[model samples]
Target: MKIWSSEHIFENPWELVVRAQWRKYPNKFNQAVEGIDVVDRQIDSKGVLRSHRLLSTRWGIPDWATKIIGSDGVGHASEHSAVDPRNKTMELKTRNLTFCSKITIDEKLVYSPHPEDKNKTCLKQEAVINVKGVPLGSYIESFVCDHISKNASKGREAMDHVINTIKLETVELQKEAKHAMESINLNFDI
Candidate 1:
């Protein structure tokens, strides 16, 4: 079993960070993630929102790895998340559904307000990787860990791109709304 962890601080508030996280996929930076589907969602009695989502990804595994695993590198994972609005925190857990016998990856992520800066949000991410019944288990574990580290960086970039896109869309909506209001006023005056 291999454990990998990382921490990052985003210069945006917790709310925005959570929004960006939900919209992170289908961005330019993280193309490996091909699709996402919401399996279930509900607001609990405590007013916390819980959601389950399935992710479809093409990890682009090397030919050697594909041949060994007898797979074309397509993978699926299920993610469960809870959002506590009162606490301003979001927690997500994901596990692989593909190659369960040979390899398992469990990942957890938490997003919350930074301890010292309310304007910033902090993300804590960790992944546990286990490879079994494989000839090169340790080597494969190491390779997967390295690949995850690289993808983590790209994930952050994707979040940033999504956040900026949201901001630009908001600006455009405001402009359109203002123009519509002006047109309405001009028609009323005439």
Candidate 2:
């Protein structure tokens, strides 16, 4: 078993970060994630947005697993996400479904507002992996742990890009609103 953790501080607020997260996949920085199909989406009783998705992904792994397992390295992952605007937090969990017990991997992520800096958000990532079905389980687990750590950092960079895009859109909208307001003329009837 291997457990790994990573953290990043995003320049955007939690609200913007969470919005970016929902559209993070399939971006330029994360080409490993090929597709996502939403299985379920709804608002919980507490008004939190909950969603379940099937994700198809392929990433770098040791060549031996492909030979020993007799299967391609593509991974079909199940992902669940929850966004609680009231609590100003977002949580996501994902696990691999293809290998199951042979090479199981589970990841959890939490996004929250930074305590000291309201404009910044903190993303905490954690992953647990097990590869006991293979002869070199220990070595494989270590390799996977390292890969996950590196992936976490790349994921953060992708999210930052998403948030910046949102910010640009917001600025454009504000500009339009300001222009419209300037053109409006109020006439007094009385």
**lDDT tens readout by residue for model 2, 1-190:** 9999888888878888988998898788768998899999999899999999999988655589587766677789999999999999999999999878789899999999999999999989899999866888999899889888877777888988888888899999999998777667332322
- In the range 1-190, model 1's lDDT, one tens digit per residue, is 8999999999999999999999998878878889999999999999999999999999898899799868888899999999999999999999999988889999999999999999999999999999998888999899899989999999999888888888899899999999999999999999
Each prediction's RMSD to truth: 1.3, 2.9
Worst 10 residues of 1 by lDDT: 65-74
Runs off by more than 4 Å, candidate 1: none
**How close to the true structure is residue 190 of candidate 2, measured as C-alpha lDDT?**
25
Q: What does the lDDT come to for candidate 2?
A: 0.88
Pairs with backbone N, CA or C atoms under 3 Å apart (clashes), candidate 1? none
Worst 10 residues of 2 by lDDT: 181-190
lDDT value, residue 56 of candidate 2: 93
